[model samples]
Target: MTPTPIAEPLFRPEDAVPMSTDEADVLAWPVAAEQLATLAKYWLATGRASGRPHVMPVMGVWLGSTLTVSSRPGTVKGRNLLRDGRCVVTATTELGDLVLEGDAGRVTDVARQREAAAAFVAKYDWRFGLRDGRAYDDSLPGSPEYAFFEIVPVKGFGYGPDGLTATRWRF
Candidate 1:
C-alpha cells in the first residue's frame, strides 16, 4: 500500500531557539521514516481502563504508512489495544527521538499478516508463522500466539539533537 501524502509539518523550536529557523537543520520526513523503518526496537505505550499506563519494548515493522506490532492477546499491551486503540509508539534514533501517536487496531487479514511477517523476517531475522490471521514465533517453543496491531499515525513528533528543533506532523 502507498503511504498517504501529508502537508508540511509545524516546526517549533523550544524556548525561542534560533537553530530551528535554518531550513538546513529541519528534519525531513524521509529521514524520520528511514530511522523508524530500520529501528530494531520500539516502545509501545498504552493506557489501562483505570488510567494506568503500560510501556513495553516490542518488535515492530514499519511498512508503508503504518507501524505493525505483535503481542499475545493476554498481554497488557495487547489487551489495552483491544479495549482502546489509542496508543503511542516511540523510538530513539541517532538524529533524535521519534514519537508516533495514533490508534492501533488489530489486523485480521491473512494477507496483511503474511506481508508483515515477511517484513519482520527481512528486518529482524525473526520468522513469524501465521494462523487464522495471527502470528507465532516460528523458532520459539510452545509457539506462543501473537496478535498484530497496526498503527496509522495521526500525528508524529521528531525532536532534533540536543533540544534544537521540534517538528510535529499531522496526518
Candidate 2:
C-alpha cells in the first residue's frame, strides 16, 4: 500500500537562507549574556492569536542548521503539529535571543530520526539519562502514535536590548 502524505506547512525554497557565524555574532551582540542564556531555554510558544499563545517548554538542541525536538506519543503540541504542520520555536540567552518560524514536519526516515535522537541525547545528556540503555528505536517502527518533529527554520529573529536584529538559516 502507498503511504499517505502527511500534512505540512507550505515552504518555499527561496525562503531557505543560511545564517553566517558573523551574522550570529552581530544579531546576538546587543543582548546581555545572561539574558541570552535564559532565552536559550526550551519550550517557548508558537501560534497565532492575540493573547498568550500556549507557552509550552520543550527539550531542544541546536544542531547548527536546525533545532530538533521530540514529543511523547500523545500531547497537545504533537496533535497541533499533526493538524497544522507549522510552529515557531524560540531560544534566548541573557545577552540575546533567537526565534525560529517555519514549516514543521515529522522525521519519518528511520536513519534520520535516529540521527536526530542521537544529537538530542548528546546535547542534553547532562539533564537526561539518554544512554542508560533506553533506546529510542525500541518502539515499533511506523507507530502511528509515535511523534517526532524536525523543524526547518524558515524565518528567524535575533534580538537584544539594543534593538531588533535578525538572521535566517537553512533547516
Candidate 3:
C-alpha cells in the first residue's frame, strides 16, 4: 500500500499563550511519527452503536501511515470496531501529546499481518505467530487468536509540552 502523504504541519498556537511563534517550536511530522512508532502503549477509544464510549489501552505499532492493533473479535473493543470503524487513538510522548482520529478496519491480509507482528516483536519484544491469516500470541496460555485492525488516520494533532505550539496534520 502506498503510504499516505502528510501535509506540512500547520502551527496553530493558542492566543496569549506563552509559546514561541518560531517554526522551530512547532512539532515536526517526523517527530510525531517517531513517537508513534516508539510509544509503548496507546489508548484506543471506540463508540458502541448505542452511543456509549469505550476506551482501552492497546499495544500497537505504527507502520507507515497506519497504526495496527489487535484484539479478540469477541472483546468489547474488537466488537465495537467491527461494528463501527470510526475511532480515536491517542498517545503521550516525552515531547508532546498525539491524537489520531481515523477509521479502523479488520486486517485480513497475511503479509500485512506478518509485518505488524514483526513490528510488535521489534518494538515490544512480543512474539506473534501467524495462523490461518491471523496472529496468535504463543506466549500466552491457549495461544489466543487475535484479529488485527489497521487504523488509517484521517487527521492528527500534536501539542507541544510548552503551552505554545499546536500542530494539525492532514492525511
Candidate 4:
C-alpha cells in the first residue's frame, strides 16, 4: 500500500532522507503480509520508567497490521512494556528493513489471544499453553507464566540499505 499516513510520528534517525510514494519501491514496506509471515525475529525496543532503553530480540507474529510478542512478566523487557506502551520493533534481512514505531499494549481478548497463540506456534515451532491466550505458564511443566503484547504501528519505515531511499507509512 502506498503510505497514506494516519499519523506520522518522528521516524528515522536524524540524517535519513524523507521518502515519497512516487519513488521506486526499493523495499516493499511498512511490511506486507507475505514479508511479516516469514520473518523469524524482530528487534523490540522499549523504555523503562526512568526513560532508559531496553532492547531485545523477540519472537513475533504479524497478524494483519498488529505485531504480537510475549515474555515472562518478571523479565526486564516485560516490565518495560508494562510501564511504558511506546516501543519500536524492527525486522531486517537481505531484502530490506522495516521499523515499526508505536505503542504496545497487553492482549486482553481471549479470542485474539488464541489467534496469537496459533500464529506464535506456527511461526516459532514452540507452544506456551492452551490453558489461556494472553498469558500462561510454559507448555512444559512448572514453566513461568508469560505475558503477551500487541503493537500496531502509528508510524513506520521500510528502506533500502543505502542511505538515499526509503518508504514511510503511518497509521
Candidate 5:
C-alpha cells in the first residue's frame, strides 16, 4: 500500500528522543501485502462502552487485508468487542510498529468462519471446528467455543523504528 504521507510530523527535534530527517523521510508505508501476512501476533486493543481501554496479546491472520482473530466468549477481550466493536490492533516487527484502527465485528457466516478456522489451524496448530457459525477449539473436551472477529482497518500507522517517521494508510 502506498501510504498517504503522515500529515503531522511524527516527532520533534526537541523531543526527548531524536532522529535524523533522512531516516524520517525514508519511513514509507509497506507496499507488500505478503509482509503483513507474515505477522505472527498483534496487540489487540478494545474498549468498553464507557471508554475503558484494555489490550492483550492475540494470535490472528491477515486475510485479504483484514485481521481475523478468535477469543472465547467469556474472555475480557471478547466481552469488550461484543460491547463495543471499535478496536486498534498493534504489532511490532523488524520493520516497525504497525497499528491498525477499525471496528471489530463478530464473524457469523459459516463459510467465512470455516476459512478462519482453517487459518487458525494452519497458523497455530490448533484444529478449530465451526458450530453454530463460530469456531470451537476441538482439541480439548468441554472447551469453551471461540467468537471470531474481523477488523478491516479504517486507518493505520506504521511507526518506523527511527521513531521520527510514521506511515499512514487509510482505507
Candidate 6:
C-alpha cells in the first residue's frame, strides 16, 4: 500500500488587505494584553555579518507602537542590529501569533530609553523579584548593559488557525 501525501496550506495574498492605522489599533490590543506577557519567550531575529540569520530569545516591551528590547552592548544580537539595523520579531499566544518586521535602531534619546526601561520594569516586575516585594529599578542610567533597541515596525502580521492578516503602518 502506498502512503497518502498530506496537502499543504495555500496562502492567497490578494485575499487580505494591507493593514491601516485603524486596523493596527484593533490588532495591537490583544498583543498588548496577552502577547507582551510572554514576549521574553520569543526569539528576536537578526542578520549575521556573513549574511545568515540568527535568532535568540530576548526580553522585550511593547510601548504603544514601538517594541523595545534591552541587552548588553557586547552581545551578538546587539552587534548585529547596530551593523545591519534590520530585524523581525515574532510573538505567539494561544489566541494567535504576532509578527513584526522593521528596522532596528539604538534608542540614544535618554528620555525615550528611560521610558522603555520603565515599561520593561512594569511588564516583568514579578520576574525581577517583585512578585510581592518592591519593583526593580530599571531606570538607572549608569548600566551599559541596559542599552535599549527600538524596533520601529513598518509592517505587522497577525495569524491564527483561521487565517493570516497583514497590516502596514505609517511611521
- What 10-residue stretch in candidate 6 is worst by lDDT? 1-10
User: Which stretches of candidate 6 lie above 4 Å from their native place?
Assistant: 1-38, 126-144, 163-171
Model 4 scores a C-alpha lDDT of 0.73
In model 3, the worst 10-residue window by lDDT is 7-16
The list of candidate 2 runs beyond 4 A from truth reads: 1-40, 44-52, 126-146, 163-171
lDDT of 2: 0.51
Tell me the deviation in Å of residue 138 in model 3: 2.7
At residue 132, give the lDDT of candidate 6.
23
Writing each residue's lDDT as its tens digit, candidate 5 over 1-171 gives 433434333445575255443443644444424556777778899986677899999989866767888889779999999888899988887777777788988989888888888887788887887776667777788866988899878877677676756655656
Error of 6 at 123 (Å): 1.2
Candidate 2, position 41, lDDT = 54
Task: Rank by lDDT, highest first.
Answer: 3, 1, 5, 4, 6, 2
Q: Which ten residues in a row have the lowest lDDT in candidate 1?
A: 4-13
- Candidate 5 CA-lDDT value: 0.75
RMSD of 4: 4.2
lDDT of 4 by residue, 114-146 (tens): 888888878786776746454665766787688
lDDT (tens digit, per residue) of candidate 3 on 4-45: 445444543555246455665556677788878887899999
Q: Write the per-residue lDDT of candidate 6 for residues 1-171, one digit (tens) a residue.
A: 222222121223454344222342344444433565555666789999999998998888876666788766568898999898789988886656766678888877766766775777687762221212222333455423445788877655555534444333233
lDDT per prediction? 0.84, 0.51, 0.84, 0.73, 0.75, 0.62
Q: Using TM-score, give the best candidate's number.
A: 1
Decoy 5 TM-score against native: 0.81
- For lDDT, candidate 4 versus 5, the one ahead is 5
Model 1 agreement with the true structure over 1-171: per-residue lDDT tens digits: 655435343454454445465556556777888888888899999999899999999989987889999888999899999999999998999989988899999988898998888888898888888876668986888999888899989888888877867677677
Decide which is better by TM-score, 4 or 6: 4
Taking all chains together, each candidate's TM-score versus the true structure is 0.88, 0.58, 0.86, 0.80, 0.81, 0.65
